[model samples]
Target: MASTTDTKNYKFNHSMIRVKDPKASIKFYEHLGMSLLKKLPFPDAKFDLYFLGYDAPQSVSHGKEIWDREGLVELTHNYGSEADPNYKVNNGNRDPDRGFGHTCISVDNLQAACQRIEDAGYKFQKKLSDGRMKQIAFVLDPDEYWVEVIGQKSVEETEGVTTTDPATYRMNHTMIRVKDAEKSLKFYQEVMGMSLYRTNENEKAGFNLYFLGYPGEKGVPQGYQADREGILELTWNYGTEKDEKFSYYDGNSKDSEGRQGFGHICISVDNIEAACKRFEESGVTWKKKLTDGRMKNIAFVLDPDGYWIEVVQNERFSGKPNF
Candidate 1:
């Protein structure tokens, strides 16, 4: 289990993905009700970071630093990546590299939300009417990353609503494929100290989903799963764990045969040193230590599937400068 001391303070913060054009990416997310919270530029590093997120429940600040909120999306634009004609980022959804599936946004009116995206000239991976599952629709971003649009209610009830407004929209979850269900469950449950709130299985489709997150008191009743935040959805395809030749791309590593487009998910901790010490004794794999690179305040640890989970704190260790 995660160290009981600081684990309670650790919360899922944001998921990062690389984009070719920050302008186009920002426009896309803005259309989906996300506000650009702040932009961090690293001129020396030749890159910029754009943090976007929806307003947290009862939040007074319409705009605040994204790192202060939970469940934000970080769009990384490396300088001149847009100008490179030969640069092709693997979206991590194609053949032999199918690992990260999609990030979800729950809407009160699924039909209206899908119509808005389609009418905006954006591409759709799966329409509401597409496939056996008509309840959820998949829209593609500029990078062709899937953004799943799910409904707040059952399909029949959702479609019956006449209002065109998707009144409540929240960044629900980010889905990733894992090899072993049991092992993955153990890691997220015990090690990360997240609660497995719900599970869904498709017996004929040969897969199961486990939704894990930290629960809190929103003004609204937390009875619905859609109301919660910072959820991690793990997809376990039956038999992949036993297959000796099968593995998903870590998404941040260049060592994989496929190029990486998706980055890491971040979790905020109270004290970086205490968190690192507990993780070390637990034998968690380290992608980058707190002091390994130029960024001394953050660390990266690998999950069982090699996906990087970034560990960070809001302020410096000395508490002089607050981020």
Candidate 2:
């Protein structure tokens, strides 16, 4: 099995989005009461970045609080200019046939967010409607990128907002696009030692669910058995042909912006230093050394499909050290 590097506890962190103008995007989200959590200057890329959340609005009073109490939406302004206000933010190049879609962020009140964004005059490719199990709706970000709002939080957030316990919001799952189901199954299962969780293997829809994680010798519950942390969801479309190798900034890849399908996933651990060392030793040092501290000791690594996987060591995973 490929070494996962000694990870602390695994929890769901945040999702990253590429943008032409972070300021404009932040303004749009701020109108809806999202607070800017952190900002980073990527001098190499000649860009400024920001992370926004739904817990608080931007204000002098609320701005004094350093600790954000909710999930976040990261916005990256590329080091360039843009003539068009409506920029293309979908990652359709990775899987052209699948149509670049929007990233879905879990919310407490799906209907309320939809109403608020709708009132703010944001366009929507789809309206707020019923889901198979929950409520969902779509809205365009300031850059014309589609987004989905769901009424669910990360599995680790057992309690509602305002809770700082790291154990509450563990990284739930990640979705990826693969060319072949059988091939991915072998790579993630045989190579990664992930079990085949609930999957839609039927070729009709051409989607299968393969879960990758470290589980206890004896199975317990759905998300409880994984001692190593959370799970990685490998999504493969059995019918369509997708780019085997895609670039996040290539701009020609089908899913370049991760708007259509589920975007990149971030997993938070207790020991990021050890994880980087292990990933380095495993011949997979794609983004070694984490290079950035804006996300609080975070590092980025990509999987087989070039999808970004972030590893971090937040305070939440400091519980009983399994290592």
List per-prediction Cα lDDT, in the order shown: 0.78, 0.50
Model 2 alpha-carbon miss at residue 129, Å:
5.3
Tens-place lDDT digits, model 1, residues 31-143:
88787887889999899998887874543223444444577889999999888776556677888777788888887788877888888899999998888899888999988
Best by lDDT: 1
After best superposition, candidate 1 residue 260: deviation in angstroms? Answer: 1.7
Residues 1-323 of candidate 2: C-alpha lDDT, one tens digit per residue: 12243332334445566776667788876755566767878787677767665443322123422221214556766666355454456543333434223444444444555665676788876775444433455667766665655444432442333323212212233344565667666645543334665554556655665555544333323643222223455555555445545323322244434333224555555466666776666556365356655443556665555555666564433433211
**Model 1 weakest lDDT span, ten residues long:** 314-323
Candidate 2 has what TM-score? Answer: 0.60
Please identify model 2 stretches exceeding 4 Å from their true place.
1-8, 31-33, 43-45, 56-70, 79-87, 93-101, 129-135, 152-175, 181-203, 209-234, 240-265, 281-299, 312-323
Model 1: how far residue 184 lies from native, Å = 1.2
Q: Candidates' TM-scores?
A: 0.90, 0.60
